[model samples]
Target: MDFVEQERMAHGIPSQGKITITVDEYSSNPTQAFTHYNINQSRFQPPHVHMVDPIPYDTPKPAGHTRFVCVSDTHSRTDGIQMPYGDILLHTGDFTELGLPTEVKKFNDWLGTLPYEYKIVIAGNHELTFDKDFIAELVKQDYYRFPSVSKLKPEDFDNVQSLLTNCIYVQDSEVTVKGFQIYGTPWCTIESIPSRCITALYDNCSAQDRKKLRRVVNTAQRITQTNLPSIDSVYTSRCLRQAANIIEDPSHPGHSLFSPLPSGRKSLCLKARTTTLKDSFYPAVIRLLNGPCIH
Candidate 1:
């Protein structure tokens, strides 16, 4: 039915269009996309987890199979919170804490009363008015010190991703409905600055990767400056607590460890944290799409 088709990542080139997998064909087949997606970052192998014991949410669908309802940081709160049944919802963004176009039209009218046939949204780091270069560097700072970003006034957050229009809004794009090949990006990677840093809401970054996400958001406001490297000792709530999730091993079939993460990796290696999280994260709006290794 021609649900949706988008692939916009200009200046960095990433579009084999719809049935995509471009990153120079995932770097000329990186180990067949790392053994077809059981990609582990060897600290000496070891990866094959199969521990799934938790189910129930009106469970009743194994027929045509295809249920994905993953949500994340529902900032504007989804009101009552009772949305289980799924056939693809996957909204991995901050439904708006400030990307406000009346909160993206009330999150596109609550994603049009969700009966998900396909939603697939993305863009996090608190969607700050869709990062028009971080609202042009927070309107050159000092407006009574960002008071919730200068009590806003540019048409109360223009466009705001065209008010969602009821779904599919990926950035750095790539989407396909039923046959699924969904790729999304809110660009972030500073495992000590290899490059890239666009906290989504579009700007195809290149002010030298927005100055390495403002020097890792100003080195988490200093720590008596000491041995710092390996990506600024990772901050931003330890990059969302070293976010990692790779599942799909329902009693292990020909198991690629239940594949799902195969979207041309380029950055995000993060691995440094002992204790940190008292409001810091935007450590370039950390987002780590999972598919962590297992067998």
Candidate 2:
């Protein structure tokens, strides 16, 4: 296949048309039963060239199409708001205010009642209980200095998973539906200030927390390389530094960005968010356009 054909296939474009050919087999004896031959390619003419027009930058999605409704940072207020109808319902993270079992159960119960055909859920920084290692590290780091809340035991992870029966729970994982690939992660970059005050969702000032964050980022990169060659989109909780690194890296495959929900409980659509991702050597700022949003 030529490079153009490969690119076309990558973008799910169809060929202009196809041609059929026939073949005849020769035998030693004229009276012998004729052998059948099947030819899959045409030999007479050149292949047709199909050209797909590029979509305009400002084109609005058509109405009544396959819509994906996205809501995030609900903070355990699932029953208080009205949800739009969509083919897929995606809850980015922070469904629970305190990452407690009761909070998780309430979110799950509300998720089960949604009318969307597909539902995807991911954890947020508040969902510390969902990630055991994260919670353990926080405890070791004297997490009590910040605030005291219901701490989840190790076994509670299984119980939380069981409660989220109606939705697909994704933590550094991918799923496919109707040939569209969607990747989800619950990581967000940690912002640290002097005096050990860490913000930006997940805290990673501790060595163990850093290692776990790296593992999640590495897993995302590996999945992108192995399973996302033909992925249509990605759904992540927040744009962690690791995710931003993957997006800004030119060596990686191209991907679309989906903006994070606004800080409050406003029904805002996805828009591009710009951020600076710094490493040991290079520091760069890039703009990522939020992924597709249909509503």
Best by TM-score: 2
lDDT of each: 0.56, 0.53
TM-score of each: 0.27, 0.44
Candidate 1 residue-wise lDDT, 1-295, digit = tens: 1111221221233444555332334344332343334334543232332234445767876554566888888988989988888789998888778675677788889999989888888988778878777775675663574476666766666656877888889898898778778888765423322312212211334567556756664563253243233332333323433332212334443233223335545223233243232112221332333324232
Model 2 steric clash total? 4
Candidate 2 TM-score versus the reference = 0.44
Model 2 RMSD in angstroms: 20.1
Candidate 1: stretches off by over 4 Å: 1-46, 49-68, 71-84, 87-90, 94-103, 110-112, 115-126, 130-136, 140-189, 192-194, 197-214, 217-295
RMSD values, in order shown: 21.4, 20.1
Itemize residue pairs with steric clashes in candidate 2: 257-290, 257-291, 258-290, 258-291
Candidate 2 lDDT score relative to the true structure: 0.53
CA RMSD (A), model 1: 21.4
How far does residue 182 in candidate 1 sit from its true spot (Å)?
Answer: 22
